[model samples]
Target: MEWEAPALVLSATPYGEGSAIVHVLTGEYGLYHGLARGGSSRRGRPVWQTGNLVRARWSARLSEQLGGMTAETVHASGARLLDHPLPLAMLASLCALADGSLPEREPHPAIFQGLTSLLARISLDPQWAVDAAMPEIVRWELLLLSELGFGLDLGQCALGGGQDDLAWVSPRTGRAVSDARAGEWRARLLPLPAFVLHPEQTGTPGDWYDGLCLSGHFLRRDAFGQRHRPLPEARIRLADRIARLADVVPPDEATGENSPQPD
Candidate 1:
């Protein structure tokens, strides 16, 4: 069987003397692994870097077998961000999360689009690191949770019907809780930033941190926790960087009252 698709290189590792095993996320194929002959060679190395967008063709005698892939560069997203540390980190973290959390060969078109949009945003503006990158990254993390079936319901209170004053998310159920409903139990719920609940809001950095914390909670509890694996180190590091940048209390140290406030 043979097929071609637009793909994002997630990871590549040496296989034989000059060959590599490449993992990629595709718009149609989801996450896939294939053998890339000469992928370790100087000529092919640039195309295999994580976060590069490529046009890839995979061919195998049997549809279920790991196939051989031949790719041509479409957009060298990673190369463009090489000089920018924070955006580079964000890209690496995004690739790592998708590579780690997603099931192989299961199509997730939304995730593919989200990733493409994120890369496009960063690529268009060299100064995205200062302005829009972090918030977009946080938002993408939320979308990842949703695509994986661990989405939070932030429209109304999980306990009461009120939409106003919705401030926290129940760690156990991944649902939003109103400030009134969480009066006593607020100490235990994760902060649901207004921006996450309402994307139209231009959130502050603190709100971005809270949004990450809210999404990270379920990412840990529902995604990695169930697999008996830890959240990717890249993700943890990105969260820490965001915490510092936002100057907000880290999720581990945040309580209801101290959660980052919305702009």
Candidate 2:
């Protein structure tokens, strides 16, 4: 079989002396791996880095076999993002998450769009990148959850008729729970930020950490289950950057609760 497609570099690992195994998220082929002949050579090295976009040609006799690929760089996202560690880390974390969890050869159009969108936003400007990217990242997280069959239902609370104040979410069912209905079980509930469910507050970052903690908790528990998998180092780095920013900026404004300052 032979095919050609546009792809985003997910990873590259040395195969032998001069060849490398390249993983790419292709538009038609989905997340697939192929042997990039002479990938470690000077000519191929520039096009094979993670985050570089490429046009790839793959050929293999059998559909199931590890194919051989000839790739040429179409776009290089790494250069623009090189100085911005937060956005770089975000991109790396996203790639790691998608690579580690998603099934190969399975198309995830929404997730793919989300990843590209985030990368573009990251390359824009450092001052406004985090503010612009956080909510979008949350949306991406929610999308991934939905794909894995663990989506959060952000509609009315399951327990209470009062829709005025739906504050927390049930991790078990991935839905909202009103403060009144929460009762004694509130302590166990994940604090789903008001902005997450409210359309009017889409860009607000109220309780962003809580949201991250909540999503990360459920993602690890529901998606990874019983596995000794570690959280991606890129994720750790992003979180640390956010934490550091919080020390200088007011916690509420920085967290996206209040209005964002101009980048």
The window of 10 residues in a row where model 1 has the poorest summed lDDT is: 253-262
lDDT by residue (1-263, candidate 2, tens digit) is 98898888888888898899988887566788899989988877888878777888889999999999889888777767888777777778777777766678888887777776666667666546666666666667778878877778777887865666888877667678888789987866777776677534644444556556556655665554434555555655555565565443333212222221211
Candidate 2 least-lDDT 10 residues: 253-262
- 107-182: candidate 1 lDDT, tens digit per residue: 9999999998887677657586556676677788888888888887777888878889988888777778888888
The residue pairs that clash in candidate 1, if any, are none
Q: Candidate 2, residue 200: CA error in Å?
A: 5.5
TM-score of each: 0.91, 0.84
